[model samples]
Target: MGSRNGKILFALVGVCLLVGAGYVVAAALGPDETTTEARPQVDGAVLAHAHLMVRAVDPANPRLNGRVYEIDGGKARRRSGDLACERVYFAGGRGICMGVAPSGVDYRAQIFDSQLRPVHEFALTGFPSRARVSSDGRYGATTVFVSGDSYLQAPSAFSTRTVIVDLRSGERVGQLEQFDVTKDGKPFDAVDFNFWGVTFVPGDSSRYYATLGTGGSHYLVEGDIAARSMRVLRDGVECPSLSPDGEQIVFKSRVAGSERWRLRVLDVETLADHAVAETRSVDDQVEWLDNETLVYSYEDDLYTVPADGSGEPQLLVRDASSPVRLDRGI
Candidate 1:
């Protein structure tokens, strides 16, 4: 049984490597350079209700880093400063932007203020995959894909590293890989453990949830910052984002036999989940528009659906990805 499972794991890793390589190539050969800057146009109803911070997706080249823009009161305007990123998230009054550094070869993360001015900058070890800031702007998390650095020091082609940063001092708090994990009341350790897609709890900066990928399963794990420990909650949940009320979690449910996912909402307490109205294979971490609706990017466009699993998907914004809800009194 162990040998058979091992073979399956190896096969899964190969598929993952191929997918990762394809992403790397697409990122490298980014969209053709065009003078036009991508801007987000929001639906009138959506604009009247929600304020959003989004990274514009260039029509000519959706892969290129687009300028940050804010949509409020039906007006779409570029952010004050020059902040463009591949993945972005903002909360409280701070934001995290991950993109190519000035050297152009290395990637970096920039901590910016509400005005979009970069307050601190640091180099990232690999390509940025996810970024999040706690609700109070006290801390931030980043996940990057690094090569040849699996937890067991194996010769794997790809692995992920998630780092928690203290936003106040702009210093590293700890790496998720160094934390302790428990599953089923027993210490759970594995060579293929990779962590990503962290979504901080609404009011608590120290408590959060993230996805733990190992042995062909993606488990949702609750983590503690001060304790530096995590416990497996359940399986088949990825890239979880807690609602503003923190009562529910919206995550991506992977479709079997394919690299695609469907949006699902689960009770944070009961762990019971239901699928949303969107039937497309969304690959991004979803954001809550207002607890009643969910917003996410698919194929470089942003869409919204009812959180209660009703109503059809609606196009919220065009040529936009990385949509961040701006309702946290920021």
Candidate 2:
């Protein structure tokens, strides 16, 4: 008697759910309603997750004089050092200009147009340091190093708060929010490797990941730029990159006394991790080509490997660092 009653109750509840779903479908997604994924609204073309180039800082070849070679080509061509990222890879054809610190300037900042032409120039008012693009590539955030007076001993130079601003308009986007944690959340101490590079939440465009090195500890930080608070994920880490589908993160880590940075993969949702590669030196750069393959730079050459770390890493260049995969206009 009890089993029969339970079966009847389940069937009635299922029927009610089906009726509700039918109503929702009929009302919400009628014949005329069209839903499109929120992507590529800027200029109609969906921007690539990352862009890269491999040409010549030095070149001497008959067939490959000085041209930008796409990574897909597996070779180089003749192109000038002044070639834009868009021209080399096929995104920003209008030209992009990178800011390089002049002989007497305080720092270097690279700026380019849609076609990658050097249309603007400026020197940072603070100490010289590192700079990188925002998640959307719409802004640039830089760390400025300054010398602080230390009466206790020898002179010392240190890096302070990071500054972020518009990459296109050259306007101040405001300073980066300092990371803070409570007893319940996670506390962090900012270090050199922390803030190495910032990556964003895929598709949504807002919220992002930041790596922090503090007090000999490194942590993965999730922050809402507009909210001002942060949550820490993993510690003793660097170079956090989001997968294209926004499902995973590939970062650099050094466990225990090991000096080498091992590539680690994490399920962004579950926060589980596994080692993918180990280079004697720090493995600072990692970008996922798809969910399964990742492209990274070690020493001067760029190599691509499976996210599972199954096969050997095939070299894409002899002397290419900072590799980001961009479309070949195909």
**How many clashes show up in model 2?**
27
Question: lDDT per residue, candidate 1, 202-269, as tens digits?
Answer: 88999999998888889999999999999999999989999999999999998898777889999998
lDDT of 2 by residue, 108-181 (tens): 34465444455454555443223445445665555443333232122332333455556667666555444343
* Per-model TM-score on C-alpha atoms: 0.89, 0.65
Segments of candidate 1 deviating more than 4 angstroms: 1-36, 44-47, 150-156
Best by TM-score: 1
Clashes of each: 0, 27
lDDT of 1 at 180: 87
Whole-model Cα lDDT of every candidate shown, in order: 0.81, 0.47
Task: Give the Cα error of residue 219 in candidate 1, in Å.
Answer: 0.3
